[model samples]
Target: MNEEELGTDLKKRIKEVLSGSLHIRHVDTGSCNGCDFEMSTLSNPIYDISRFGVSFVPSPRQADMLMVTGGVTSNLEKALRITYEATPKPKMVLAIGACACGGGVFGETYANAGGIDPFVPVYVYVPGCPPRPQALIQGILLALDQYEEVLKRGE
Candidate 1:
């Protein structure tokens, strides 16, 4: 299906399967910090993502989703694995921007590990040098939708 259709379906499924709020833990593996700015915009006056029941938390243990930015770097690979393990099961991993999705221009460098998928499963990928806030929101919703599907399928 098209992105538009997928987005609508995600919204519907999220509402159907989830109730109340969800806490997200933001992880910055390695990047130019461009994606971080777009993420901050999500909570700003214009978008105000908190109204949608998503809040950012500091710890992975307290989070339902892992909002990952940047490509994984060699130094942080172990930390990333530990964080993923800390996150409770039935979790969703949201890979934001080109860097996190596939390492962007820094692909497979000596210091860059490319993507988070090899270390942790990525449920939704938002592709852009810095994806717009709308895209970020869509990615979050998509993650929720996928999480709901996983729960329903008992997997």
Candidate 2:
């Protein structure tokens, strides 16, 4: 599909995913807070992801999607896994930023082991060293597509 059509399709799928009960929990593995900053903008009046039927939760256990950012640090691996496990079935993971996707500039460093995919099954990858808010929103919409697929397969 063309870009516009694809975006429309994604928005439809996101609506479907939100038709059911779903909430997102954000995790900052070891980012420089740039990704976090962009994510925070999603809640601002302009973007207002809530109007799109998405909301961020505080606890992982209460979340249906895990929005993770930053390179995965060895110390945070266990916590990340625990958080993923805490999320119930039919969960989705969104790896935002170059750091979360492939460790960005921190890859192979002693501090960071790798990206978030190794720690959890990432459903969507938003690649940017520090992604813009619009890009992050697109990633979120893509994740809702995955979420809809899972629901379709009756998983």
Candidate 3:
């Protein structure tokens, strides 16, 4: 779907699954910031994800979803785990970009731990060197579907 359609769908999904708001905590494990930059665009006028009831929170404790970018670096592994633990239950974790999805060019190294699956349960993976804002919205929509299913199962 187009970005506009995706945004409309995302708004509906957030209203249904999250009481009309979806607070996200964005974490940058150890990326070069490419993915993070793309994610930031969602807040700009062109994308304006906030208009769809999505907003980025400063703390995981206040977030309904975690939008993680970059490879799981050794230095940030503990921090990532802590953030995931801090987020309330029924939370959705989205792995953004190729690095967070896998290892990207950085790969598994002595300082990087590859993908984040080993640290936290990821509900969606938006793969790209730096996925566009449209892809991020789509990922959130996909996560909302899974989150709704989990809620129905009472998990």
Candidate 4:
């Protein structure tokens, strides 16, 4: 095979590595805990996120994806940045609510850093004061699609 063909084959392999499942690491910057509650329900028997190959891990190092909620408050900025850094490469960050996506009601206040995107790259932005569990699931799946595309590009 030619070099060009080999490059295409390599990209295909990278994408295939991400097609299976995503284990998440959830972070709450400075929201009202509304989105956190919704995330907790995802693991319950009703939502059963595990069945979908989505589960929350305790440490960022062990997580496959990062799910962040609430605006990036100044106090939590370092922690958020560090957590994102610790998560492995090719990891996707999902902004779980309006605050995390674009600061919501807080909106770049003295204490808020606007959105998580400013601190770390965000792949999917799930909008809502506190989005429904279903929305979060959809956001994860959507990010998964983008995630594969990103890997294909060798980025």
Give all TM-scores, in the order shown.
0.89, 0.87, 0.96, 0.85
Model 3, 14-127: lDDT tens digits are 888888899999999999999988989999898888899989999999999999998998999999999999999989999999999889999988998889898999999999
Model 3, residue pairs in steric clash: none
Runs of candidate 1 with Cα error greater than 4 angstroms are: 1-15
lDDT of 4: 0.80
| Residue-level lDDT tens digits of model 1 in 1-155 | 34655445444555676666778898989878899998888788887777666688999999888888889999989888999999988888999999898889999888998988888888999999999887887777667768877989997
User: Regarding TM-score, does 2 or 4 come out ahead?
Assistant: 2
What tens-digit string does per-residue lDDT give for candidate 4 at 48-145? 76665566889999887899988988899999989988988888899998898888888888999888887887898999878887777667657767
Candidate 2 local distance difference test against the native: 0.80
Q: How many angstroms is residue 105 displaced in model 4 relative to the true structure, after the best TM-score fit?
A: 1.7
lDDT values for all models:
0.82, 0.80, 0.90, 0.80
> 1 or 4, which is superior by TM-score?
1
Give me the overall lDDT of model 3. 0.90
All candidates in order of TM-score, best leading: 3, 1, 2, 4
Ranking of all candidate structures by their lDDT, best first: 3, 1, 2, 4
Q: What local lDDT score does residue 135 receive in model 1, on the 0 to 100 scale?
A: 83
